[model samples]
Target: MQIYKNLLLKNQTQSFIDDKKHEKIVVSNIQSRKNPEDKEDFSKLALANYLDEDTGFNPLGITAYKMNYFLPFAYSFGSLGNDNRKMEMKFQLSIKKRLFENLFGLNEKYYIGYTQTSWWQNYKHSSPFRETNYQPEFFVDFPLENHSFFNNLRLGILHESNGKGDENLESRSWNRIYASTAIFYERFLFVPRIWYRIPEKRKDDDNPDIRHYLGNFDLNLGYLGKDYFANIMLRNNLNLRRNKGAIQVDIGYDIFNNGIYWYLQYFNGYGESLIDYNRKLQRLSTGFLISY
Candidate 1:
C-alpha cells in the first residue's frame, strides 16, 4: 500500500509545491532520581517537562512550543555528597517546515525545524550569569528505515544543544541523542540501543575526564501484551565501575470498559546511574497513567 514511488524517478523535474497539512501536541516528563546506594540522605534530583506542537499553512509549515524546569536540593546521608542546592528553569518555542519534500528516495519524507529558549539558574548565592541561554536543534523521524535487514525497519533522531558544567543548566538548548529500531516479534518489541554523552564542545576543561564512558544495553519484554511489561538498562559511570547497572519491571491489567488502564510496577535493581548500584538494596517505584 506504500506505492507513491520515489521522487528520484522524476529526475529533478516536477510541478511541485510543498504539501502541508497536519497538527500535533505532546507532554512528557524526564526524571532523574537519586541512586539508592548513593546512601547520602540527600541525592541529586532533576525534573524536566516538555511540550511541543506542529501546525501547517505557514513558512516552513510548522510551529513549536517547549519548556523545562529543574530543582536540585542539598541533602546528605552521612558520607554521601554534601548539599549545595541548585535549580534551573527554561522555556522555548521554535518553527520550521519542509524546505524540500520527497527529494531523494521512494516514499521518502523529510522536514526542517528550529527551536529557541529562555531560562533562569539559581543556587547557593545564585549563579552570576543570571540570563537566558540560547541554543538550537534539528530533528528527523523515519519509520521503516533500516537500509539492510533492518532497512525500513524504523529509525529516528532527537538532538539538542549542550548544557554547561555542574555550575549551569540546559535552557534554550539540550543535546541528547536517541535512536530506536524495532520489529514486532510475536507482538512484542525487540529493540537494541546505544547512547553516549556528547563532550559539551563548549564547557571549561577544568575536568576533561568529566566526559562519561559509553556502552550499555536496554531490553524490553512483552511490549504489545496487556498483562506484562519489563525493562532493563546498564551503564558505566564515574560513580561505580564495572557491573553496576539498573533494571525495572512492570505488570498491569486493563479494565475492559470505561477505557481505563491500571497497573502495578515492581522496581527492584541497583539504583540508576553508577552511584545507586548497590547489590544489597532495591527500591520499589510504582505509578499509573489513565487515558480516556
Candidate 2:
C-alpha cells in the first residue's frame, strides 16, 4: 500500500483582534486519496490526515478512480488546533457511459455522487452537523492535439440533492458546463479552464436550501522545470454575487529523496468542489509523502 501526506503550519499571529477567526494554527491535508473510508483501513488516516508515527503510508492523499469513471472520490482533512477538527468523505461513481457511442444527442455521460462532512467542537460549530448531497450528472470531453495545444475540452450537467435534512431533503439538480485547453512544450504546459453552473430553484414549499447559479474561470501553468520532473499550476475563480474567490495551488518538489520521504502543499480560497460556497480560502499544510 503506497501513501502520501501534506502538512503545513500557520503563523500564530492573528490578522484581526478576533482570536476566534481562522488565523494561527497549522493547516495540513491530503489533496487526493487512494484508499476508501473503511474502519479496517484506519491506516489510511496516517497518509490521509497528518503525520502519525505509527501509520506507514504517506501522510496525504488517497487512491482515486480511473478516467472513464463517472464519479470521483476526493479526500481532505484539517484542524485549527487539537480540539477543533473537521473531516470529510466523498463518493462519486459513473453510471451511464459510451451511450450510443457516436450518437450526438443520444450519447451522454451519467454519474451518481454523495458526500458527508462532519465537525468537532473546538472553535467552529458548537454542534456538528452533516450535509448530504445526491447528484446525477452528464458530461462530454473532447481531445485536442495530444502533445501540442488544446489537448481536451469538456462540458456537463449536475443535479444536486438538498443538503440540510435526510428525508425532508429535496433533489436539487442543475446543469453545468466546463471547457479545458492546454498548451505543452516538452514537459512544460499551461491549461485554461472555464465553467458555469446554472442552478434551478425548487417550487416545493418544503424547499429549505435556496438554489443559485454561478460562473467561474481559471488558468494553470506547469513546467518540466527539469527532465522527468515537472511542477506548476495557476488557478483563479469568480463567483456571481459573492466576494472574489481566492486559493493557493501547488504540488511538492521531490528532488531530495531519502528514507521516509514525504510530499507537501499549501492552498486556500476555492474549496474541493469548484462550486463549494462556504469552504475556507486560507490555510497552510505540509506532510511527508511516499513513492513520490
Tell me the lDDT of model 2 at 122: 24
TM-score of 1: 0.41
Model 2 over residues 149-240: C-alpha lDDT tens digits? 55445555555544453363433334446665556555556667676655445564333222221226666665533212223444444334
Which of the numbered candidates is closest to the native, going by highest lDDT? 2
Q: How many clashes show up per model?
A: 18, 39
Backbone clash pairs in model 1 (N, Cα, C under 3 Å; residues 3+ apart or in different chains), count: 18
Q: What is the C-alpha lDDT of each candidate?
A: 0.35, 0.37
Q: Which residue runs of candidate 2 sit more than 4 Å off their true CA positions?
A: 1-83, 86-137, 145-147, 159-175, 202-215, 224-243, 253-261, 270-276, 287-292
The digit string of per-residue lDDT tens for model 1 on 1-292 reads 2343555445334423222111111111111222222221100110000111222245544543221211122122222123322233323345444444345554444545555443333444654333333334443435454443332322234354334444533232333455544444443445555444445556633323322332334554435343223334333442455444444554433343222234443334443222222332343322332221
The TM-score values for the models, in the order shown, are: 0.41, 0.44
Superposition-based RMSD of candidate 2 using all C-alpha atoms, in angstroms: 19.9
- Cα lDDT for residue 105, model 2? 50
C-alpha RMSD of each candidate structure in angstroms: 16.6, 19.9
**Global CA lDDT of candidate 1, please?**
0.35
